[model samples]
Target: FDEDYLDPDSDINKMGRALALGGELDDFTASLKDTFTTPGSQWQYVSIDTHVIGMVVRGATGRSVTDLLSEKIITPMGLEHAPYYVTDGAGVAFVLGGLNLTTRDYARMGQMFLQNGRYNGQQIVPADWIAASTAPSAPTAEGQIGYGYQWWIPQGATEGEFMARGVYGQYIYINRADGVVIATNAADRKFREAGVSDQNIAIFRQISAALGGT
Candidate 1:
């Protein structure tokens, strides 16, 4: 996220409706050229960065995203149900926001993070990565919900408080200090409404506080 793409008439926005319907990703990426010749010059929430990284992994590993996720995580987590990813019209996995999982399965992921990436007596993800990624290191606005590697650290986050927030209303909030994991799901398109995210964070903090008897 190092470019400015806020223009309503931006190339990506021109066919955004079609893209939402099922346009090819090539068309989408081509529409939006890389604006940041040098990254770290700025910080913007450009969603395509993740899809590009997913493609890189696919290219480097000669493996599908599903295969890698299943082998390295999903199967090991012993989820109650199999998960599926939503693909684009070209059949490429939509790496950004296409991962679909059951609420319990997501809670398992949250629990893994809560335990510093350990789950089911095994280290699923490196504890160091879990700590570093969830840290509020991003250059997000001060006093707002902060962005970590891909997690959300609410303002005034307490010891081990963070969340994974889906573009849709899916949220997995974990408070390690309280040993609480709250996974919620919704399709409210109005989730972007003002104060919605802050309100949700406050609610999660309240829940955690009550559970911790603090």
Candidate 2:
């Protein structure tokens, strides 16, 4: 975690080259760890932290995140297909943006959250965990957008409005007050181009409003 050696561009190249060279999976994982260790005490949003979180969960449960999620959520939710995680050379799951699920499957997760972690008459995730994770718990400025345990809350949104988001424009927006769940997946690399995210949030809000959000 050399602060001066934090070259994300070069890291991308290294990952690609390692894959091309058929390096062992452990090699990639080691490189990933080397490249993505925490930078500072600041609250920067690092995607690698997701992997670390998964490691923590695995350490606690002695099971992979994929296995836990599959047994606890995916199978019980009756998903049509099992979600997958992109893995390192050693087959360790990338717990952040590596998950791949169909739109309907994603919606099921959102609906579960909208129901306070209930799905098909059972609690998939703990209701208290849902409540805690969807609240504003980060160090963001007052009145600015807030971050919870892996969840994102738009600026000025009500307590019942929060979302799970990923790179690109993928989102599962929930408006609990209105009983609305919106799931979207996008391939827009330029999703950050001016007004895009705001527009997307506006659209979600509009949809929630149309559904009678409080």
Candidate 3:
């Protein structure tokens, strides 16, 4: 959380090093000062954890996540324009929050998932993967903001309801029962306020209901 990442013993120095000095799994420390408990013991919202999954994908497939995203998801979705990922000094793409895509494209992605991974008459991504990824499998406490593979399941979310959220007010809200997808981008400073996320989800629900969706 500190900008002075040069200190060797900083909280997130390993991740900073991975971004700058060509990160390797061996160089990473599992938790920051043991603040986190045993793995799978609980759910913690850490963006760096997303990078580990990206690295695993890169290592196992011998391909960059960016390239795979372009080939497998972006291209097949028939987006209006090509999307890009923000990278670190080591050219490693930030798979968690670095994706830059048009709002329309975001909605298209939501629609794809809504259709169970079929887009433009093609099964771009596997329906089973979509189902599994959007399920509430994470260890987040019940009645709270649930989580799936990398998606957010807001409180009071009905079945097949999930979202991809950003630090700001950015969101790609999807509700399959309603056949709705709402993509939004915002920079509201009060995004972290209590009830903000719930309010946003409520608004989306109202909109979906208005659009003849569930």
Clashing pairs in 2: 25-89, 25-90
- What TM-score do all the candidates reach, one by one? 0.87, 0.84, 0.85
Alpha carbon lDDT of each predicted model: 0.81, 0.78, 0.80
N/CA/C clash count, model 2: 2
lDDT of 2 by residue, 118-211 (tens): 9999988899999999998888777667899999999888768999877678999999988899999988877757888888999999999898
RMSD of each: 3.1, 3.8, 4.0
For 24-120, candidate 1 gives per-residue lDDT tens digits of: 7655765565565467765666667777778788889999888999999998899999887877677777776778888998999999999999999
Supply candidate 2's per-residue lDDT for 158.
Answer: 77
lDDT of 2 at 162: 95
Candidate 1 clashes: the total is: 0
Measured with C-alpha atoms, the lDDT of residue 70 in candidate 2 is: 79
Ranked by TM-score from best down, the candidates are 1, 3, 2
Q: Where does model 3 exceed 4 Å of error?
A: 1-35
lDDT of 3 by residue, 1-214 (tens): 2312345765455566566666643245344345446767877777767767887898899998888988998887889988877777656677657688899988999999899999999999899999999998888876688898888888777889999988678999998887889999788867878889888988998998888545
User: Which candidate comes out best when scored by lDDT?
Assistant: 1
